[model samples]
Target: MTKTEQFSKLLREMEECGEDEQKQKIEEMKELINEMNTDDFRHVFTKEQFNKFEKMIEEKKISLENAALLLKHVGYCKKLKNIWIDGLKESLLNKRLELIIIAEDEKKKDEKNENLLIDLCECYISLSRGFPPELLSICVPHLLKKALMKGKNEEIQKEVEIVLLALSNIDHYGVNQALYLDEIKEIIQHHQEHHNLTQLAYQSAWLFLSYRLFFNDKSFKEVVANELHFVREAKRELVELTRQVDWMKKEENRGKKEEKELYIFFGWFSSIGNFLINCDLWNEEFAGLICSITRLLRVAKDNYRDIRRWFISILKTAAQKGAAKVDDLLKGGAVEAVLEEILQPAIDGMTEEDCFIFFLNISERLNEKEEDEKEEEERKAAKMEIFEKLEKEGYEDAIFSFHEKLPKAVFHPSFMFVPKNLSDYLMHL
Candidate 1:
């Protein structure tokens, strides 16, 4: 028989095989497909034939191994890969493939189908960059549903990650249209109910939402206001995560679990902070959030260096919420907490840039307060109080000492506009 006939016979045999013979037939099909070159394979399987196999796979008439083998073969041929992706998009749009499958046999079907979904998701992700908007329109909702589905199987978990990663790459406008704020809120709420799923849900939510903010100016402010409820939920989650971190810190045998939890907490906190800053969505509640984060700075001192760095970065970003906001942060004692860390006699693990940025924020806030204050006496008194506080913390000595240790690059001419005294000190260093 010719190659086409042989392949057709193999498929028939595979379909006819009983449970005991299915595995062997799947292996034979995979081996035969592996032996064919792209051109010969493409010549044998027309679009009609390809769709037939796809239908068989979707209908559970073929094993996943056979389905994967067919997909792998399609990927090997350039023309076929393009056709396959187009076909997948069409199938998704036509509802031929159910993206949101509600399996009655959850465990059994999940075990059997998880890898299949993962493979399909990976294929979609690989081909999705700069995809036509129509394709994204068809694919994104399915991806979102997959991302929000909770499964304990490793393959299912991987499928979730791939779905989120794929969603992150689609056109932000497409993503926003496909995943509206209300839908996102529902996913967040669903995941929040399960403690273990919260981090993954927040991480996925952040990745998906960030693209919207990054791409659309109009969507930015709208999302900030509309998604405030989700943001508040994230803050609550962060508080719970911080409590976990604090508890883990006291344990003698803290390992990857503790470290992972810390990273997740930071991810949620930083993402929310960034979203707020990016959209200029500052409010009194955010000021309160900054104050709370500042309290955690001293607590993080004895923890990992990364934890300390992340806390400082969060504070630094919070400080950048303009002059009045910075003043609020300072009034909430952010400066003292930050300065205590910066003025340490022995520098341990913190970077010079973090220290400089913290100080620069303080200086800017001081200058801004001076500029905003109409009365000279009030400005002078405010400046004197800040200076006295700094002096009490040995700020002058710390600046001179840290200046000498800083690299010449830190004093680049680009920074010549820094306050004259600070610039002069850096120059002398």
Candidate 2:
């Protein structure tokens, strides 16, 4: 055995031998290989050394436990030579087909072999890393979707996180996800309630899925805005996040995992919120989105500014695009969040246009006088901070100029009230 293999064997066998016994053995093997990589606890194994170890694995009937551990160790080393690493990977891949068949067979039977499937999935996870992603990635999405489909029954639910971990290692591009988009969405739709899935498991899946959707433009549009109804699912997740946040507010001792899950949800929502602006169909769903996103303001403190940007940009684009409902922005406290939170101390990119168009939309809404006195008062109160902030920022001249430009549109300088009509104009579109 090479020095590296010897070390591996020693580490593997550490539990079985006493420290005294190991010391005597090490003394005898002192000449074997004392070299080490100084920067990290890793070794650059030569092909000859790797071949001998590879041959040992091939010839001997190794336990899955040891093989998995050894593979994990080799994968972690990072300094190993490519050929040697490829040799180990090839061995694992050759062994993988048989395991998959056996796991599939067991999956078909009553009282399926849970431990066997679990161990097999764990081994696959170990083998999932390699170039091209085709080495071990091709069959993973099928297994992941199957696991999710049966997840509610607890049959393959145990393997959900394992499959997620396995798939995450490969599929750098979402080739597998694209191939299985419908099934992916189906499982997501089914699990929207997170019935049997753990918070970690659910968010892990969403993190993976969100990355895929937000990245590829075509898939994203199809998944979210097209007939798929993923838009509604986004709202569902946002609602859950807000619910969890409110619950956390009441609890004295919040679990770190729960807070982590909320962050994951917020991260997902915030990314998707930006993505939603590009979709052609911005409708009532967005109105609900506003409230859900606004509710998350307190919970998303870490990402406050970015989330607020997404909020503002979405409204800005929708206002321009003509599908926006301006009243929802006010009712949802989006105005307050923008002026008080995002524009506070004067963000640079917030030129007069972004602020003016927002006011123009308000003026368009104001011209209609649709809001009764009661609703008007509530809008004023909700935007009081915005009003005060604008006054403090000295936007009176800009407001007067914008109001002069839009005489027909309603303009109340005191509360900076402006009317809508962007969405009204685009409604025909």
Candidate 3:
């Protein structure tokens, strides 16, 4: 038999060997391939044959325990590492080996092995292209949530975070749909009662928001609302707890600090605000929620200036976008009052040049309120000039002319200057 035939024979025989016999056969095949003159071996085996042999070897090693053993006398695990590192192409068929290495705690005991597991997870995630949506939908979230729930050690936690970040990058609704509300609820519940994962709590809340928004399923909105309520309650509980903590009280007395946990509620409230605002849906509870958020911002201002500003910005944006829903809040004039307070700090905090630019923006916004026709005409003229300039620069038919298309209304000088012919005006477009 030719060398190619011999490789094929070994692969065929591999199925009959016991785990040890299979390893021996694999080693024998490797030795035959290694010992042969490189040029002659290359000349004998076609590229396709070589690829098939490599794929077979990779599958055989990865499935060692699953397949019935052919030869009972040879060692398999000894050859497994070399086959993994050297024999197989880093293809999807060989990806299972990575899962095997990372499956058990013992295999991952060594730091280097742990690192390798992380690297392989990352590599598989990165290189997995042409992966069908159905598979990705089932697989990615399963792996991510599994890692997050199961990974307790610091190293494993870090690895799990990396996997989640990778999953987040896929940017598809199907990916988010794969996760159930129950899973998210469990995570939130555990984090809330345990106090062990407050940081993760915040991260997961934002991630859940992203998941819901991108998925755009209304059913999840109620779930989001419930999550928001839980988070809000947690925040209140934290603040009350902090007030009781001795060190926190001492710092408060010295005017040296305030409770940091207060901002957790702020974060949660902002997300809740978004959910309420976007659906154009509101209830008495939501109204009270915003009011409480506004009060919280006012209280947290001295200690957390940045967060205070951010909360106010969220309110302003909501009032602007959800104008009808926010009419009551605007009537309360919380935004206008807060803006006045923010104005000086926002301006005073800026460099001279930035302040000047900011002042100009303020002037523009202030100017927008005046319903002066002259200013409007001037702005229109300026806009027309810009449009004309753009049109002249080869933007064909960039501007449509209402006047040109419509017939001119004749002034009969009899009654008002209104057109006698109605169709003339109607054809303006």
Q: Against the true structure, whose TM-score is highest?
A: 1
Candidate 1 per-residue lDDT, tens place, 59-109, comes to 777765556545543442322122223344444312333342223113465
RMSD of 1: 11.7
- On residues 63-110, what C-alpha lDDT tens digit does candidate 2 reach at each position? 444444444434322211111233434454435534553556446557
Worst 10 residues of 1 by lDDT: 76-85
Best by lDDT: 1
Order of candidates by lDDT, top first?
1, 2, 3
lDDT of each: 0.55, 0.48, 0.42
Off by more than 4 A, model 3:
1-139, 147-176, 190-196, 226-277, 299-305, 320-324, 327-333, 336-339, 342-429
lDDT by residue (229-299, candidate 3, tens digit) is: 53355335434533433431332353212322333334444454455455443444444445555665555
Query: Which scores better on lDDT, 1 or 2?
Result: 1
Which residue pairs does candidate 1 place in steric collision? Answer: none
